[model samples]
Target: MTTTQPIGVAVIGAGMAGRAHLAGYRAASTMYDAGLPGIRLVAVADIHEPFARDAARRYGYQRAETDWRAIAEAPDIDAVSVVVANPLHREIVEGLLAAGKHVLCEKPLAPTVADAEAMVRAAERSGRVAATGFTLRRSPAINAVRRQVTEGPLGRVQHFNGHYWCDYGHNSDAPMSWRYRGGPGSGALSDIGSHLVDVGEYFCGPVRGVRGAVLSIQVPDRPVPLGAAVGHSAAVEVSTERRRVGNEDIATFTATFASGAVGTFSVSRIARGLANALGFEVFSEGGAATFDMSRPAEFTLADSAPPADSDGYRRVVVGPQHAYIAAGLPMDFPGVGHGQNDFFAWQARAFLEQIAGLDRLPHCPTLADGLHNLRVLDAIVSSATADGKAVTVQ
Candidate 1:
């Protein structure tokens, strides 16, 4: 009744995002293995050999290489996950596209807008499945909110309030790494703020312009690591060498959507006692809905119903009726909790469907979407630097 095809997959950059993508492929291969063909974890490439080898064994890859070009040119690899630094995205993506491999690149597409636009153009002409990792879109809560917005439970968006807060940079000795020094588009805005930007568009519509912004570095400088840095907090190799942080550690911005709905967004990497505490509340003429990633399993929503009492938020446990839940878990199992990796596996399934030429799945964010997000990040920076002056996105 259904057709299945084998796919060869490789992941570049064995860092955090790289590990997540590779593991997702493994989970999807087994969890959603109905008509899905077995995927070969062909290889993993990283700048560091230890990183590559470690990820390869941990993720069940067939091989590991220090050079990403090898994976790009590997004849056996049909699909690639570009999970490297933002500065390296455009070149690696275009190269992989030229080799005719389907690519799912990590978000904040590139360190600059021009590079992202170029990648978009390359993806357009390559005729391959090109996806960007705005992976949070796969969350069931996000999908539930989207359904409400489109189905009229929430009428027209009037205002959106969102925040992505983390305590990773609250420490004084945090080492400076690629994420901290990836030039203009790096830092809190592009790091976590990119997800907020994407979620904003998903909740309302495309933001037409930015009305104001305040971007600041919470920690003025961080100790430089002399050796290989690991994770968010790594000890410097016997040195107190420090470097100035070039980007904002926090960004607060106001945006106006094309439909004239206004919104405010705040992102902070130095918010103590919180890790990945991202959430949003949208107010529409019809009603309001709220979501928090910390909850992961449920969201609070309300409709414009006649109030007699009990007119507060309604807690929705993500079940089979919600998006992508049945694919990863038993929907009938009430009170079942979902985690972030579940979202990643679902995203992998979507990409597999994309490669299979199925149009019913959620369209993974394209290079164009990534570029638009970059523009929004850019406008926030511009607005912030100009002391909160409005900056229009073109």
Candidate 2:
């Protein structure tokens, strides 16, 4: 049933990515032409008082909340975005779902597979619109490449190579926090590789197994923070005390897809000179395509139909005709650049649309898909633990 009344929405986190969710909800109504229900910016919540207050003021939320429990218990909130820490996801999400709120959770659904499984079951019981945040899939160029793979021209995908590199952990002076507390695949692999793995599966198919996996800890220890650390930025007053890092800074592995395609994935948070470098190359029987997240608006296609002399990758600049572009942008024209945060807006719109029952097929990944991603990541870590032996994705 289409929602007849405005959906009351609140965000439970007020930090970097949390702010993005706030903005996305604020802009979700303006992005598409669907007669979507109006969104009521009810509240913004954070443990830090200033963060919640600032976000509420900036995003036009009605009020600021210090506890997420307030959002869960509120009669006015119908939907909520849980953009908090991974370890806290299950508790917050379960609480919200039990309170009858539709949830949009951040990726790496939980710290472990058991937690993810529990979340999936909880979402199943709620019968609410529960989604995982895989915002990279909303990229117009990436979706265009996915179409080429599935809708012909590219033929059968043979190999997929993806890499997500960033410098968030490159500095030795960075403070230790929840980001460095996980084990094996929980580091860079889960941080960004989760998106890469999901994108690979979106293009080729489900990964069956993984081998030759390596998880490395470039910085063994980090300084303890004397103040609150926001997002990936280093803390300003880190104490002299250092803590041992419990997870890898880099992860690399080869994967076997169900479609008989082989793939490679490399992710690192300590890579030098690369900030938000998420890209992939797909080699198929008929053609090949490449997409770099650094250049979010276009992709390179090497179609095999051209003559031998003209056999080179052609740059395809995304336009209004591209996926999610026609009505997604204000101008909705060619060469109008969109960035990473725009993906969040599109994601918010799609989530709200699903809740409104305006679409048949799901536009975002479900909690089950998030569970599968965690399984694949667990398999990768298992492979690394077994001296790079092939581990089946269970």
Candidate 3:
């Protein structure tokens, strides 16, 4: 006798992040079939038929729909992956929860704090598993760092610095995308700063308060696509048709965590020569720990107790012994090919395992995590608008 897979999965949205989720699910399914419990990719949904169709075919989904509601309400799909833009998060997530489907939503859960709170509440009341895509928390290196800090291997945590920098805005001609908009919780802070904020919380604990500064530069006026050209790659005369963006391309903030740890974070889309350069460092009484996405397979550990003659950071290569490391696929096998592949794969597996009743979901960075991140983001915007005056992160 053969046992069937336990759950049916649906992927919502067909953009960059949606594609990543599809790839992750597909990879997880492949891995599961090779000994792990498997999940079936049953359906996919997107506003764009082409994207939905193509992704469904590529990811081995059995069905595709242009309306997300169809996937959300489909009795066959047991879980939904929400990878749409920030503005659509609340509606989609609430709908999925109401439909009795488990949800895994991408980061920056909602466009506003109120909406994020509502989403959290809905998830809580629905009695369904809900998870936010704060991918950094799943990183092996970061996990190792978290272990060191928590276990006192790194002694008392003192200072933390996290930076997420990219060159997406350096091109003066880069067409206006939802990411550069204001109302959608777009801009540097929500797009990338969310990750930094999550990392800060993960390492040092909750943020009590924060102060920040924001700046908008580079292609202040972007050409808007005309009728029938929306979401298509096209360029026309630059027009300042939309209200000057109320969001910033760069933001830097400082915060005090619940553990009394002081931390600093900076996020930028205008930095030239950088592409998705996310890195963080934790300074403790005994030592310092660092991880740079640019150098994926290695983490650095400094000896705070180094002899007076020499004090420096030692590089630690993540190998087979690291957590989540299965036999053949050594920690360093993939290298930077997918900077956080192991972590992401592990997260996917965990989600699948939870659906299969094999494990309990982590209580961390849950819906509450999204709300806290949003509150911090709101505080950042308020502080920036107030000329860097400190704002309490409620």
Candidate 1 lDDT tens digits, 268-335: 99999998899999998878999998998788888967485868788888887787766576443657
lDDT for position 385 in model 2: 95
Candidate 3 Cα errors over 4 Å, as ranges: 1-5, 30-37, 183-185, 215-218, 226-243, 304-310, 327-338, 360-364
Range of the 10 consecutive residues with the lowest summed lDDT in candidate 3: 227-236
Identify the candidate with maximal lDDT.
Answer: 2
Model 2 lDDT-worst window of ten: 355-364
Q: How accurate locally, in lDDT, is each candidate?
A: 0.85, 0.91, 0.76
Score every model by TM-score: 0.95, 0.98, 0.89
lDDT of 2 by residue, 1-394 (tens): 3576899999998989999999999999997675888889999999989889999998999999999999999999998999988999999999999999999999989999999999999999999989999998888999999889888699789999999999989998899988989778878988889999999998888999999999999899999999776688785689999999999999999999999999999999998899899999999988899999889999999987779998999999999888888878888989988999999999999999988888832478999999999999999999999999999999
Q: Model 3, 1-394: lDDT tens per residue?
A: 1224667788898766786777777766544324445577888898878888888898788988999899877888887889887889999999999999888988888889999989999989998878888977767677777778888479768999889998877775656667767742368889889999888888888888987655454457565544312221344344555434556778887898878999988888888999779999999987899999898777899865677777788888765555454432333353423356555556676676666655443432578778888988888888777888889888
Which number leads on TM-score?
2
| Pairs that collide, model 2 | none
Rate residue 372 of model 3 by lDDT. Answer: 82
Looking at model 3, residue 66 earns an lDDT score of 94
